[model samples]
Target chain A: MVLNSHQRATIEAAAARIIPADHDPGALEAGVIDYIEQTLATHDGDHAQSYFDGVRELDELARRQFAAEEFSSLGPEQQDRILKLLEEKASPFFSLLVRHTMEGFYGDPRHGGNKDRAGWTMLGFPGPSYPKGYSSPLGWYDGHLPDDFASPKKRSDHEPE
Target chain B: MSRNEAVDVCIIGAGASGLVAAKELSEAGLSVVILERGPWRQRSDFAPEDEISTKRRHFFWPTVEQEPRTWRLNAQSPTEFLSADVQVFSNAMCVGGGTVHYSGLSWRFHESDFRVKSTDGSVAGTSIEDWPISYEDMEPYYEKAEWTIGISGKGWSNPFDPPRRRDYPVPPVARNSAGAILENGCRALGLHPFPTPMAILSRPYDGRPGCVNKGFCSGYGCPVGAKSSALEALLPKALATGRCDIRPLVMAREISVDSGGRAAGVVYIDSAGTEQFQSARLILLAAGGVETPRLLLLSKSSRFPEGVGNSSGLVGKNLMLHAPGPIVIAIFPEAVDGHQGSPCTRVMQDFYKTDSRRGFIRGGFVHPRAHGGDPVDYALQPVHGARWGLKHKDSMRESWRHYLHSHCTGESLPVESNMVDLDPEVKDRFGLPVARITYTSHENDIRLGSFLAKRSREIFEAVKASKVIVPPSRLRKLHNHQMGTCRMGNSPGSSVVDKWCRSHDMPNLFIIDASVFVTSGGLNPALTIEANAFRVCDYIVSEARRGNLG
Candidate 1:
């Protein structure tokens, strides 16, 4: 609700390009925009002005470069071009956008992002193993340790009886 | 304004040391009052499943705006106010303090660690001093702390470890993939690697459940009461005595002195923002390294113009923060699955001692990090060189489960210039001057860090890692391992506290935290802090019994 529908569309488009969907779901499908909006409304309210300014700048740059109506109307390749230019200029808004997009895509689902654990599923991560930790020989490397592995020295040598 | 009746002891900060002292004094039949600046959080309050809620939300610590700290390289450099996520010598402010969220790498300082001055001789421009107490003197208390607060490890496993009277209460936790790989690599190089000593429960001891390998050990509190924080282990006993009162959300503003120039009581702000005073016979400060010295500097009176314990003018000098070395990340062909156990399961202390041949007076330890498997943190890492687009997403998939990281923790020599002092400008939410830290790592620390980084690279190479990335060594702005603001010594002229950790100026004022450490050893300091608290409280109890404390 902090951003207008037009501004939200532009941000969603930028986020999609940053983590575009391939074989697996990306930022858009993971609801990264919701995370960004929720954060801007709450903990990161100070960054709200910058977000509005950045979205307007993105639209202006897209229209100037690609003869587009707005940034959200641009093709994927055109959007990538504008983002790269912003990155090359070391734009503060671009930096913020990238950081928040990654946070939303990868952060926990409780933050209004990573919907249905799509981001975790993409990386094959079994999210948050609390209340149930794995036992010994957790993975291939530990399971394959040789039987002749060296053991630690005996404590009985120094400890009192 | 409100006033409370006089108590036998008034302790500030319900942290690791304070909680231990509370249990000790209250059990010995003394009335105690503990004032904590933050809320008392239970195990259930921790959100292990949400990284945003636990790690990124400043859940354990205060926001940068709430308690801002300024930092500069040295007096010559311009000070920069740090952000919340920056390493600013911040510790958890809640009941158990940093122990609630620490990785639990419980280690006793090596024998040579105490006699740094005698062993290494004088290092130029450093205040490295031998501890008034020795390892032999601390051995019994170390054993007491390990048994009483549940540590799990195989004793004598680390050859470099100092002599001990007893083994750990429980065996070591299970090894994860990263630990296994590191262990194999270390053995290939003929170096010894042992199971890391942890404060977490391995098999149920002292009524707590054993670790299920919940994987979120370092930053998140144990939701199942498996981590042996002071909250789970010690404070319960203190409260059960019915003589101890833990007042949370109350900030101690100053240590008030009597007209006779002796110790008196404390003035604090209650949770409702009301000014209040609590009188006591004894005033103990365990408010961590930074806050402990800050409080001492703030408690100024006409009887003690330079602050209660500032007569020596060394109250806040000789600050030592353990320098974190290069973090080397390696990508292997196989899945490491590092996020299944404690943050670390194996540690190499082969390089822990001082080796003159290495071009550094002291050395550091290298260990395999279990944090590489964390999704959000790993994705945020700049190792891939690509910020966004298909390349970034592809790199995440390729390295998510296939990478492991190695870390080195080195000692920072105590430099007189690197210290905590009151900032002339910045103030906190309470309208009090914030602590300004001026630090520059000693040359020895830089040399030690680079040496350990090379060792870590070799270990990763031994395991046939496809790619190894060693980030350039950068100065750590600050570290969680804060030490040596009010160092302990034999003479009042050079140190704040004496061998018994009593303030040299105020006999009834004791400091039982890492602030009293004479030297910052090359290891995690939680176990040592707990042991020293036990030792100091024993001294206090003995003195009280003999009628010498009045």
Candidate 2:
């Protein structure tokens, strides 16, 4: 359950810019890194564990390129160069960490990732609808919904009138 | 030496088939008891929060304590199977079976589908034979299945669909923006793209409510009774009838027989690892295509050494799964908005025909599907533009508008080499043999894939897509509708089960699922499985009435 402190900070910060918290929540806020770590614990037999190790390896990349404190304190642009090196090595660890973190951000909130469908809803995305259209091209119901599903509050703010 | 319980019928595996079997047998004045190996987890208890259990999704009853059954392409490869960089070969390890976490695209096979050999010549390098029965014989049961457990669809939309006595129980869901775009593209190409039939409830038929359109519908069950999964569809009503005793977490190890050679009882282990025996007059193995064969191969007795009733030695042979991946996902300029409708809203079955020119005996359908491309799947998609800081940001900005994909479920030839044999090394917790899958796609499979890919390109060009990234293989094999292994046939020497789905050697035993299909009918086998089960049960009911338990 224990995470690498500085490694956690780096992933959390990098994931933020990758899928920032501007409109929808970012990776760390949605527990993307935590999910990645937990997924690694059990599925680590696959490339997932290497991904977690890749997190530590990312820190090593930063330290090897720059002094330890200097690399740790470097800004987002500098972090990007280190990531470019990580991606080029095709580091299974870093790719897996990134892969899982993105999964958390986009997967269903039921998996404790999307956080109230914020990631989906923010993109003005509608959820899974039925495909009946039994009669005509028009689906069942006289063709009109009651403003929203039971409650209008849950509907999108910019829903069509 | 555990306490024994007596029952009229003991159904192994609490999957959709087992649930339906329990309902029908119980209603027909027979005592039915279902033994599910996995622990029970009610809908409300399913939490999305826990990372170990939920996010990783290990909370769905059975634990993968032992390594999952592995797969190898061929014998030449190391005994070890390709674990990663390939589709994860998974079987549902939960109470309700795969229905709990399926994409819910339910489809019935076409008429010509049954008579594969008779319609087209025998597929070489494989044993792709016809089923014992035809679609016409099972048509009544298909309608009955639709009515009994409600289905939502616009009937006759699929031109290639077999005749139906009745319309769909419920109407189809509304088309989404993505579907509208695809419809236009298909029509522009002089093709028909009708509404895709789904297993989801559209108009609140039966007791379940209509879909809320929450969108997150794959690898997860509906919290609101929208999806017509077996747990929500049949088991509840069957249990309420009081004729069925459902035993969760009781894994049926083997079917024990008596000196007279009938199924005396089933030996099993419950959740707490306690062994118990349940004797029954009849044993129905609705434990899916893979598990059924594995169980039959594991349940070796003096009466039938090649595993119970497997005298023909076809129990674990000629396995095939509906291949749906290795496809193309193109990004368009305008919005496809794939997130709005049912996972699959429209399909073009125009290409689902047997063409010798394609260098394959059977062909596949071209389908337009709305992918559940939540943020996690974003990077996996091919981007037209470069992928970097600014470019990645630009792609994200265009994502809502630029996603389109097609699925091609083509001919996956059944090969004897692609068999499921018991792993000598790995066994489940209760000391039964685990299935080791060994398969390699034949030249026919590759050729069929190539044909589907060319068709996909033609369709994309007709639609004037800015760019199309067709994978080297036109067909995608990720649908995972695995079939065969213990197929039904006219002769006992050539197949495991007779036309009635009764085991040739063990008269009292029946396996009526995808396992009974001699050749998969170029479509998803869900609806067909239900129909065949009903057909076999009809024969069983008649024979039992004639005082013929044997």
Candidate 3:
């Protein structure tokens, strides 16, 4: 409810470019737009004005540069080109967009983003398992210490003066 | 709007020191009241797996917006309010304070740490003072604190560790991939590596379960009471004593003094926004380093115009935040799976002394850390050189499992210019002036940090890391390990508190926290703070028994 349909579309397109879908789910599929919208409506409500201004500016730039009706109407390649230009210019809006995109894609699914634990799944993270913690020999390196490993000799060569 | 009957003792902050003091004093049959500014969170309230809430957001309460602290590089620079996510100088305002979200690296300062000035001689532009008390005086209490609070580690494993009378309460936590790799590399290089002494339960001890290796430590509270925070180890005992009354969500505004220039009580704002006064015969200020001095400065009165116990004009001077040493991130071919246990398992203290050959007076410890598993934190790191698109994603997938960081923590020389004072303008939600911090790391700290970073790189190289990334060194802002604001010394003209941690100007007022630290050692300060609290509380109990604490 914090953003109109046009604003939402523009932000979703922007987030999609920031974390495009390939073999795995990306920002759009992970519901990054919903996360951004919810954040704007709540804790980060103060930045809503800047977000609106940024979205409008992005649309304006898309039309002026690519002859598109809006940023979302542009092809993936054109969207990427505009994003790269914004990045090169060190645009504050672009930085904010990228930061929010990452948060939505990587943050916990409880926040309405990273839907179905898509981010955790991609990273092979088993989320928060509190009551049940893992035992030692957690990885290949720990279980397979070098074959010639020996108990370290107690040496004071580097002892403090 | 309300006045409460006098208690035997009134302590501000239900933190590491205050809670310990409460348990000790109340057990000795003294009626005590503790005022904590944040909510008393239960174990169930902690979400160990949610990085966004626990790590990204200020899950510790009193976010920067709620109580803003302004900071500047030095007196000449303009102060800026710190952001919510800036980890620098951020302390949890909850019942356990920073211990609630701490990494549990418990350290006993070496003998040389107490006499830094004597050991290293004078460093120009720094106020390196020897502690009024020595390690020998603190050793017994250190033993007491470890046993009472449940520390887990092998005694004398760290050859650089100070002499101790007894071993830890429990054995060390099991080592993970990062620790094993670091051990191998360190042994190859002839460096000493030991299991880190931690304040977490390795096995079930004192009715608390052992850590589950949930990979959600440091910034997150233990959901299973595995972490031996003051909240878990001390507060419950204090409450059971039936003489310790903990009032959470109560902000102490000022330490009120009697007309005779003696400590009287504390004036605080209760949860319902009502002003209340709770009279006490004795007062203990354990509000950590910054807030302890800020509270002292806020307690200005006609009898003590320069603020209570600040006649020496050193109430907030000689601030020392432990130097943020460099971190070396390495990527190996095989997965480290760092998310299987606590971030740190092994520590190298080979350089934890004054080594002139290293081009720095004080040295630091290096530890291989397993803190790279969090997706949000991992993605936010700019080491990949790509901000977005397929390249960034590709790098993330490739490097997420293989990354391990070797972190160094060094000693920060106490500088007189670095200080905490009442801000000239900004105020908190209580309408009181906020604490303004002016700080800049000493040159020696930077030298030591960079030197340790190179050592870390050597360790990584020895382990055959595919890539070792050492970021450019930058000036550190205030870190979490704050110390030396209200210094303790033998001379009343040079320090705020006496060797017993009692205020020099007031007989009945005591400060039992890191604020009383004479010098910051090259390690975490939680254990020392707890030990000092025990020693100070013992003195308080004996004084109360003799009717000498008026």
Candidate 4:
């Protein structure tokens, strides 16, 4: 289920609105669109039709209200207005996109998003402390372990790109 | 080519109950063969410490895409298709069943739990009944389960606890910071908080090490064999007895009954996808609540058209799920770090028994928990108004460590309408009908849940913690303690299995799982199921020695 240029633009723009780019890397910089695309291509192909229907509806709404041809062509303010309409009318699609966006941004990097572990690093998460599990008799209330406890370079080095 | 074998007893599903039965029967010199639907998972299979691979990979449960179940809130509603991954009623499909990935809160139902109907009267719409066997009859078996399976906790701590023959086998697991905070709050409210009885090892026992506080026990298997899963505790001993043959990836299709109306053999799909018939003198069904009823419902013979041992038409009826009533969270300035120790290290059981003043038939327990263990799950919890970006980031940083979650584990009443049956339309990968669930919380259940939720709020307030968040009132569809599809009772008219977990209609067949639970108690049902398994095994062993059973 390859996404067309319009589909890709719509998804990327909508994902950016969910987690917009700022001083820190947001969903766009975190590669959430790629994550969603890969998910739709692989395990979650059943949800592809929902994405198509949602994008079409958003474009239709954009044409009616903002005099825009497509959702991606609109400015940030106009895009948010269309998103709010989607939240009201096509909530199932909007909520699904929001959930997938969160998964792509916050889930493990191996799933195709969270590039450079940006989502985790931004949230001060050290990924999973596998094999060598965390042990603190005093508990997590004491303090977090050093960031050096897990190395992103060493962690991603072993995995196939 | 398919191979045929014969054993004295053919047991389906090598989970908590089946493992115990196999060990007991094999040790008594009876040949036993156990058929497991899923692969034989070992410690190596549980190596993935990440939740994504462990949970998402379907390590503990069946994949919903290929094997789906249909669900409808009531009989009138249109059934919606749900993969086992998304289905709330699904349990483990591995070597040890749900015990492999269970949180290990090993609780014994109080004496009153066994006789809910007799003690508390009927709750209007529900058909609650007393078990054929009393708590006194089950006390010795509970002790045996504790000693053999190795539970860790002090006994007789809770005054509301039933009479115990002995204490737990080992000391309780060490408490995390939340345990201390919960204890202080409960004590301030004049409630007795005790160390929760858990199956996890607190000290090196039976060649297993103590818990190391890894903070991954909720849905993940223990890296070490400290969790006391059947895969870790019982199955190995059953295998050691050479009289037992444990075959994994062998799915039991149906039980074949002889002209005498007794279980004669089982036709199953082996790992190679070849059909094989394993003849046996006796058959035991321990395939959890859903699968046990499903297998029985699937095997419709001329003698039993409505399914075996279902003469009363109750084999797939009376399904009950525990209500994980509204959750109450307390916020503190400091990080209570709930993830560091056992998830259920301590519990306040002040309301374990029913009080008429509470306006509910039975009460629930307040068990404190740590919410934000991992980053992905922590990030999913949003602040009151923050959507994303810096505001969301700020909320995650400030609130993740500070929040402590506690729950009211309440009892769900067993209504005839709430049930598990075969889906007329949907089929699994094996080309068999998948289980369909029809359930809705009873009116009394909703009231009970609301009462419990109110109690949870009071406990959180007593702690003097900031930013208390009470989850919205809703009947949760999630099933942690699913039971009572094939209820056990004295009369064959009202039950599928008798007091000994043997099918009343089929003398040679037995069932020893949560399926035989007449009433689900307010607490977790793992320990009670294990204890009942031990009792049933003892009955089978003695009866077999007397030549009453094959």
Candidate 5:
């Protein structure tokens, strides 16, 4: 899919944060942002319409505040502030886009999003629980993963910039 | 001539009970044909985008078009359109019935539920007959049903519980932070807070996976086959036998009765829009609460007038709906991200016991739900209040952790006047008369709910909630757990069907579903419906062997 450089960069940043695979697999490296855009374009999912709406609404909202300049043209701090404002004005809309993007970035490939379960290995989430009921020893969660459960973007939830 | 269609049984309506019936019957060497009215959506259908499900309510099983034609207020008040939310009066049109979008709550009616008439001493002007069968009759079947549907939760005869045989298949879903808060408060006040019996595959059992806590599950089908629905769990097994044939989009218009007043076959509109007759020595109607009665009412013949089974004239009377009790949301300082656990993970049955002090005939279920904060739902939380430019942003910041919602599913008393009748003129996409629903909660209904609201508030306060909101009582809509239209009685004049759900007038025809419920349980009816269907299917198979269809 062809995305503007700035849109790609922003999505890449969001994807990189959600799928932080410091060592194992990576979110951006797993091509989650691409998955989000692709699902939005092809899946004909209900979430797709809202995202396109969010894109247009965010652009208009930002323009009302800072003229019709490109979102990427704004400094990183300015872009962050604009996102914060969007979060305030339309939290459901903004959160939904981000959340769906993450879901696509992390969901099972059967639904056409997280192609290889790469998103799972990255988050230390073992693939869907096997029917054996966890008799197997946790070779990894034997404490390799953090109990904090929050995604990277959610962890820095308040960071305006 | 070659046989174009062949099956020993054709089960319609893939719901809590039909699938159970199909699974067991199909396993016994009988060729079975299953027809579902809705689409077969699975977990792969959960897009979680702010679109189809949340907005359009797209997960419509066969689609909500077949909902009972119900009226609000009464016959005097013209029909008002009711949404699927007000009264869970919804039945899924697809392969799983309502189980596809169910919260996975699997509850057995307290033994008292069957003996409501004898145990509770009777109510004036109420035809509260004891259930033809007792809890003991269904004890083994309940266990069988649970194990088959793959229920997951710990079940002991909690002191307040009725008799039970085995424990739940898995540990209770971890109560989310809201449950923790409620549990602490409940224990402090000495009220029991037991983990609810759920049908979700908690640690993974059978062929399905466990829950990932995506949060918003109830209204959507589990793509992973983890949540037990007929489509995901039982019917698939039935179909795997190769003895069962599933025909989609075929609509059964009526039962064709032979001269002897026995149902010889059903005339159905196949997907091709052509009418076809599928002959059967025995016909079981699992078309659900709304359409089942509508079909019988439409199948008029010389032997029957009110419809196929209307000789008793009670085919569509006594339309009972479960009471949708007042909801109270108690806010806590901690992040009660309710979106984590299955919706009905915990409930307090303090009020389920029959009590006259409350001035009501029966009980209600007040349960905890950790449901829906996925964005649009979270933004509308009452705590968020009205939105301003900056204030709205502030609320959004706290969105994920700011809320928890609680619901009380209570009992709506049965009133003779609340019923489904054929409309004078209106018809559906099919030319059948619309299922006109005329209903109004009796004054006692309002009083009972009002009384329950007080208890709900007390529970919220005892839990040390930071904030509590109790919605006032104003003729609330019924939850979709609709039942009691084609009730059972020993006599044909009083009930539409015999105790076995066989139609009194038609003899060979059977009507089972929520429509056969003689009394609506105080809570969700899906489990009870499944239990009854399980019991009936056993009787059906054996009776068929004995040539009872004669």
Candidate 6:
């Protein structure tokens, strides 16, 4: 059950409003739409139709408000306004969209979201320290520094800028 | 179907209890065969700290999509499908069971915990009662489990804690900086804070290396073989004995009986989907609390029509899970760097006993821990003033390094209505009726949870935390520690298992998991389960030697 072009646009635009692109990379830049699209094909496809129906509701709301225009065609301010209305009403559809968008934006990079570890880099998270775990006798407990506490840089730090 | 030669003992589910049982029986010169439903997962399989791979995907256990279970608030409610994300009765499925993925906090239940009903009197609408055995009876076994499993911690710190004959096998792990801060707060509030006894080794013991400070103990398996999981500590020895045969990826379908209505063998399906019957002199069931009872209920026969060992009609009754209190997340002024060491190093057991003044029969233990080791969990777990956008990101970034969260594990009373039974409408991949968990936290549990939250706030305030965030006071599907479905008692009328975890009706059958817990104490039941397994297996070995099993 692949999403249609109009449905994809609505979800992508909706995801942007949920975690809009600021100076930092937001949901759109994090490839959240791609994550959700991939998730719909997995065993958790029972909720896929609900997501499509939810995106349809957003489009219907946009058409009613902006004289028969799709949600993605609307301006950023108008998109934000409609999302705010959904939040106020506590729409289950909007709630589902928000959760999926967050999972995509902040979840693991291997899942086609959190593109290039942008979500982690922006938040200063070291991102899955393994193979080279933190050294023992962690002096942080006693308010003591081991000097050069930041020697082994994060895995993301080695990635090309 | 293929038939295998009969062993001296056949154990279903090679978890903490089953491993101990196999080690004891096999060491006693009895041939033992352990049939595990899950794959033979090893330490190398869990070496990586990938959150998506380990925590999200649940490398230890199969997802609810694979082995589906149903959930309902009460008996009358319409059963609904429980997803892996929200399944309440979450039991691990791999070789080591939950010990492979648990937080490694190995706590012994207090003396009062064994006889809660006797000490505090029974609460209304719950089946809370005294255990058939006392603390003194289990104390020696507790010491044995602690030494064998290699616990590391300070002893006799908490005045209310049950007495132990010897100190821990090793000293407590190095206290993390965040743990030190919480310890100071607890001392200021006049609370007795002690080093938490952990299954993870501080130093090399029992031929295993010490922890590497991986900072992934909460939900991830230890890579360095430091964590004293059953697979690491016991199973290797059992397998080394040359008398134990561990058959992984073999699901125990039903416990077969002889013509004389005695224990005979187990019919299980192999990983290749071929059914095989392995006859044994004695049968031991340790397939967790829910699965243990489900196996019994599924093995219906004409002689025992309601299911084997269910003549009391209480095989799947009296289900209980430790309902954790409102987890209060508090932020400090400076960077705590919580995700650098073990999750729990210090525990405040000031409120681990019954106190009527708090309007609760049993109290909960409050232990502060390093929150958010995984990046994804922190992003989702409600950080204050963060709906979305920059505020959410800023909150997550700041709190990831500075925040500490603590929750009280409130004791849940066993109610007859709160149980696990076969769901008529649902079936697993093997076309077997899926176990339906019917649970609603008792009123006393809710009140105790609220009380624990109030007390936790006082400690946070004492520590001068900048912001204290308390979630809603409701028990969700946090089911890492589940127990008490196939309860133990002296009488056959009120319980499924006897004092030694042997089924009342069946002489050669035994259940050695947390399912035999008469009461769920305010602590992790893994240590107790392991202790009871060692204890019961000792009895089984003696019986096998005497040729009394038949």
Clashes of each: 0, 19, 1, 1, 20, 1
Question: Candidate 4 on B1-550: residue-level lDDT in tens?
Answer: 3556678999999888999888888988999999999888887778544545566455677777656777888889888876443552467787888888888888878888899888998877798999998899899988998888889987887777888878888887766656666666677788887778898997799887887666667777787778988889998888899999999988898888888788888889987888999899889999988889999999998888988888989998999887647667677766676556677776778887887887778877877775526555555554335655456656766766667777777788889888999999999889999989888887767777777777666766675667777777554453757799999998989998899998989998999999899988888888899899899988888888898874
The full ranking of all candidates by DockQ, starting with the best, is 1, 3, 6, 4, 2, 5
- State the DockQ of every prediction: 0.63, 0.17, 0.54, 0.20, 0.05, 0.30
Evaluated at residue B472, the lDDT of candidate 6 is 89
- The clash tally of candidate 2 reads 19
Query: For residues A1-161, could you state the per-residue lDDT of candidate 2 as single tens digits?
Result: 43567666766666655565654456656776665555545555465445456666767776788655533466777777787786788766555556565566656565446666655565555433433212222221112212111123323333567
RMSD of each predicted structure: 3.5, 5.3, 4.2, 6.1, 8.9, 4.8
> Model 3 chain B — which ten-residue stretch has the worst lDDT?
B82-91
Regions of candidate 5 where Cα sits further than 4 Å from its true position: A1-161, B1-6, B46-55, B61-70, B84-89, B380-384, B387-393, B474-478
* Per-residue C-alpha lDDT of model 1 across residues B310-402, encoded as one tens digit per residue: 777888888888865888888888888877777788888999888788888887798887773457777778898688998999999898888
- Name the runs in model 4 displaced over 4 angstroms: A1-10, A21-24, A48-74, A135-161, B1-3, B82-89, B372-393, B476-478
Better of 1 and 5 by DockQ: 1
- The positional error of residue A129 in candidate 5, measured at the CA in angstroms, is 14
Per DockQ, the best of the predicted structures is: 1
lDDT of 1 by residue, A61-147 (tens): 998999899999999999999999999999999988987888899888888999998999898888887777676666677767642
In candidate 1, which residue ranges exceed 4 Å CA deviation?
A: A147-161, B87-89
Better of 1 and 2 by DockQ: 1
How well does candidate 4 score on lDDT at residue A45? 86
Quickly count the clashes in candidate 6: 1
Q: lDDT at A46 for candidate 2?
A: 61
As a whole number from 0 to 100, the lDDT of residue A18 in candidate 1 is 92
Between 2 and 4, whose TM-score is larger? 4
The whole-model C-alpha lDDT of candidate 3 against the native structure comes to 0.86
